[model samples]
Target: MKKELSAIDAKYEAQKIAFGPMYFQAVVALRELGILQFISNNRKGVSIETIIEKTEVSEYGVTLLLEAAEVLGVVEIEDEIVKITKVGFFLLKDEMTRVNINFMNDVCYLGAKSMTESIKNGKPEGLKVLGDWPTIYEGLSILPEPAKTSWFEFDHYYSDNAFPEALKIVFRKNPKMIFDVGGNTGKWSFACCKHDPNVNIKILDLPVQLKVAKANATERDLLDRIDFHPINLLDRSQEIPQGADVIWMSQFLDCFSKEQIIQILENACNASSENTTLYILEPFFDNQDYPAAHHSLVATSLYFTIMANGNSKMYRVEVMKDLAREAGFEIVETYPLIGDSYHTILECRKRA
Candidate 1:
């Protein structure tokens, strides 16, 4: 391990931590004001005068934002010319970064203010920023504008890319019926139908989400192959339907607390027969290859706590496996690092 920071260095680090939100806002301002893009287009570095003239922002405003960005290392000012750095490039053009920035700014930032309250009360106190709901999912249908856009984009970003490979795994046995739990927008169910014409899908989710999912399937002329079941799995009174040869949950379990996850899994066990296979896809934090991936997963736990639900988190592989066993399921296979994605597939069956 490296040496601990000296008192002076520690103070500097603490100041940076205290100013974290301001730093993020500066980055956003740089992008919003078109200064980063202007410098990026010039490439040879643009003078403050030129940026002010080009973007039409006041010189004082431009200078203040760029100066802050220089400290953040997203830009550099040398010989009075500002140049965009690699970090700036990621902020401007990287898809993941773009999605993350928008998601944080639009979906999580304001609600995050209620984090302390959420933690104290074991509830999504931050969710008040959007609407009055126990969790974000109930409010997803009504979430406004770019917040809605960013939310779905962030949600799909981590799970969508894995579908092609996961489809292969799900269809390996050519199951006749697949139950898609938490089938948001019906993307997976549509993919399932296109992958196999003979297979039909049952989508189980909240009524609001089911309405959207059904509309999506109808627009694609795929509704005939997909059915909808609107139920709140969080309610212990609700039970998953039976007769699905395959039960599918893609990036779904992380929305629930550990106890809730076990309860849902147990309900799934009741819905399953010996021949049924339950495929769970998750991006377990510890199973990630990169430290950044792990960091993002852990940070997302707070989002769940403050915005989504009060108790769920991006779980570790061992913790999830234990939950599975507790729910009377036996893991038949574990497929890690599924196809250029940070997801793992657990193939499970009912316990004997």
Candidate 2:
């Protein structure tokens, strides 16, 4: 019993010592392997020699990386041959994979090193780590070569996964038209069209984002039914496109202040008709004692504020109802969308 306990204690102590440095070393190895880009280009698998040659690293370094990757199940090694695993293939194939890598490498990794400082300060130094770029997209734009490609990968991941789920929950029945607010890349709009053939989507977003949205819509064969409208939310005179039965705000409102949210709500109210319904799907903050809830709230809330100049506060269900009421709308219902977040539908009628 004493021998077993001693062995266990030693193992725990060793883990404590190795954990931090091992994680850091893994990041370095990833960068060295050109893993993100290699996976993106090949999508099959690349040998250690190929990685070493492409990344201009030594054979010794490549071997180390291959070993580490095999251990992490990122790569499979047999008979001195290496191949990407299923998870590895999925990560590389997904558009947002690279973007996520860049985010982790540039922002999260560096910021995590100073986690103690952030904990003490009660905020992240994401802006500082990200440099001159204001938004996540802007930061991604300036990334070197393959890293930029990774950004596209990341964008696709969020669009492919999050938007579809949100749209399905929000627009179960076919609607004639949908105004997708902050509809970058028009993924959600495309999703709406996919869900219901009769649906027409109008995407409202920043000019650059609108350009991307248009391209994405075209690629998805949804350009005919989807139109892009360039409008800054801060511009009060900006007209909200009308004749839409659904006003979709998928992953949008969280990127603003209370006043800004109210303004947007008012605009949505004005744009909506008697039969129009406003849909909002976003991460819901649950005041639960569970670790998952706590981690999500803390991590996401901090991320929005520091990185995007936005609030990640999970708005109360009542808060939305009150906002809608003030803006001449009545709450229909709020329910959990497939995952951790909530979906809210607000029905509006113009004041008499």
Candidate 3:
């Protein structure tokens, strides 16, 4: 929303966007090849000859990537000597940055090429790059190599940190049974079980996800208190079973289009009693205080377009509230900025 760019600066920025892919790959190569780390270690700056000698990459490869990195502001070069910039330091060490770059490199990089096709067809046309599946969720468990590792790391990084704080809110009412809707891998379910020994978790998700979740539960010796009800939440014929004091969906609803979200929430309401409290944990862009955090959420929208459902995007807070209202739920309380994480928990109750 900042619209004060000078004409020349705007033109230069446009070119940056045009060559963004090249810049991104260069940075990734530098990181993977240890060239970035090498430069980082030599704070006084390393010579091009030293980088070429110390790393497996050729002199030509090192110089080209370093040149691109310099333009990208990831490194600074003076008198043919290279040193890691502040940005380079983050690229090397920041946990969130590491996850984001890995996800882009492993999961989204190939699929991004089909974005226009995906937009035109309203399907994940790019998903074919990894394997065949309706959406990324269905194929997550079987994703080959670094894709599987990077995908789970990316997905879990955002929601896992918020789990501990969410547990406190969920346990306050002393609920015995909580339904984990779209509970991928039963991570949140495990957290709930550990928080209160008596609480039971019934996870409702795709059969594929439940398979992994159930296995994880069994491995942790928590399956006795946890159960699974496999259902394609998108199917109108399927509804979550009744009898629970809490229904929770963390980082889940944003995976669906607004229309789908309404249906999903309506179904959640159908399974709820007058006393049931529905909790939705999402990192709504509007709720983020920093521009970079907001930027990351919006960028994730393209992943949905090209690789995920191809219909949903990271949503604004007001838009989600509207969807929840139409679904016959009202937000009674909100827990924002939970535990140094960008996630916000919407504590909702069924409207009379």
Tens-digit lDDT track of model 2 for 1-352: 5555588888877885677558546745665567645644654556666777787878887777667767666777666656777666655554334455564554455445544554455444455565555455445435554545644554454335555556656666667888889886666777778788888888988887787778777787776898888888767898786798888776677666567777888887888777777876654455333554445445555555555553334565567567667766666766553443333333444454
* Clashing pairs for predicted structure model 3, backbone only: none
lDDT of 3 by residue, 1-352 (tens): 8889999999999999999998999998898899999999999999999999999799889989999998989999999899898999999999999999999899999999999999999998889999999898899889999999999999999998898888998899999999999988888998888889999999999999999999999899997899899999899999889998999999999999999999999998888899999999999998998998898899999999999878999998888988999999999998988987889999999999
Residues 262-286 of candidate 1 have per-residue lDDT tens digits of: 9999999999999999999999999
For the record, the alpha-carbon RMSD of candidate 1 to the native fold, in angstroms, is 1.1
Model 1, 295: alpha-carbon shift in Å? 1.6
lDDT against the true structure, per candidate, is 0.92, 0.63, 0.92
Per-candidate TM-scores read: 0.98, 0.63, 0.98
Clashing pairs in 1: none
Error of 3 at 25 (Å): 0.4
Any runs in candidate 3 off by more than 4 Å, and if so which? 1-3
Give the C-alpha miss distance for residue 97 in model 1, angstroms. 0.8
Between candidates 1 and 2, the one scoring higher on lDDT is 1
lDDT minimum window of 10 residues, candidate 3: 186-195
lDDT of 3 at 165: 87
